[model samples]
Target: MTAGETLRGLLELTRPVNVIAASVLTGIGAFVAGGVTSHPVEVVAAVVATGLAVGAGNAINDYFDREIDRINQPQRAIPRGAVSPRGALLFSAALFAGAIGFALVLPRLALAIAGINLLALVAYTELFKGLPGLGNALVAYLVGSTFLFGAAAVGEIGPAAVLFLLAGVATLTREIIKDVEDLEGDREEGLRTLPIAIGERPALWVATALLVAAVLASPLPYVLEEFGAIYLAAVLPANAIMLYAAYESFSDPTAGQSRLKYGMFLAAVAFVLGRAVEVVGAA
Candidate 1:
């Protein structure tokens, strides 16, 4: 491939927007956990490692799900001939190795957590993706790692873990809803996504229920007197927005646009609420 073509393929593999979102979550977790250490170098290292891992996961996912993407996401790098499957596989391996080395520079607890996170993504692409409910659960766990990574950077775990858990649950619901939205594409590609295996209405109901629970439970930290009232005020409305989007999503199950909007809104909620917790706790 030409240099520009190779770069474009790499960029797609990295999914830069997703990496930034993950890094922001990491920063928020560190701040909220009161673990904001002076280890800027360590934090940078963690961010690079985490980014590489996420990129690698995306590349590997694309490699494994090539057939599915051919139907579901035709313009993806692999399907568009921007990157070959074998090339992506090699890229993933190199990135994974780099992440492992970077993780080793951190504390043992952080290292272990990073390793587990990488392993989870590997499992996700290799085996878990085909499983029914387990796929969504693993995706949540993978996303939750950003919080753990942040907490580990300061060699501590705190309220941020709870936030991580809440975000994970919410994202899991999004994943299920996405599955519902992609049911036809997945079915055409002979994939076994949740909505394909279970009925559409049932999957939508489960997703809506989980979203409601996640949004409702988001206020617990403030309610328990762990966070200031500012956090409650800031996050509650954000959570409400998230719930509203999810609710709207349920009414239009067939719309990919709605599902994408719901996903973006869910991410916004996380960003807003996480920053709110950080600000309130900092003050």
Candidate 2:
């Protein structure tokens, strides 16, 4: 392959959009904790570290899942021969190193979270991916931990606790749906994912139930006085979209998971807006 193609493949392996979204989530966590202004450097560090870690995780996952992707996603970088397995591994390692470097400069709590997350990312594909719900839960925790990591960076994790739970549960729901979408390849590979352990319909039902619970509890941030009316208003629509997405998953898992991601992004935006309103009101 040409140099440009190889570069593109390497970048694709990192899943840049996910990296950016995770970084934004970390930034929101710091903002919600009221540390963005007081702890600007730490917040930046946390955000960058989160992005790097997510990129690293994605790359490593692609490397480990190369075989699976050949069946489920022939267009993927590794499967398409855009990037070699060894190259992906080395690139992921470099990203992990960068994440660790940034994380080491943060507080003890943040450092601890980062350390655990990095280890989990490394172990996830090989050690946990075959388990039924355990893999999904681990991925959910990793996603949710970005918020806690940011809050910890500023020495206050309480404010972001609700966000962590909300995001984590929502992510878990999506992960399950994704498993259903990947059922064919997972079955062929003998991977015992949630959908494989149970029936596809049952797995989707579990996902639906989880999404319902998360939607119902989404208003807690406002009710608990952590956010303003704007948060409630914004989150209402986000919750609706997520619920609709969950309903759609039973018919078309691909569309459902994609829409669910959009809803999650909207919810994240609502979080930033709510925090902004509170900050403005205080000012």
- Which candidate ranks first by lDDT, i.e. highest? 2
TM-score of 1: 0.83
Q: Model 2: per-residue lDDT, tens digit, 179-222?
A: 99999987987889999998999998998898788788888878
lDDT of 1 by residue, 69-96 (tens): 8876898888888888899899999989
Question: Model 1 misses residue 29 by how many Å?
Answer: 1.7
Report, for every candidate in turn, its global Cα lDDT versus the true structure: 0.73, 0.90
Which stretches of candidate 1 lie above 4 Å from their native place?
A: 67-75, 79-81, 254-283
Q: If scored against the real structure, what TM-score would every candidate get? A: 0.83, 0.88
Q: Report residue 67 deviation for candidate 1 (angstroms).
A: 4.7
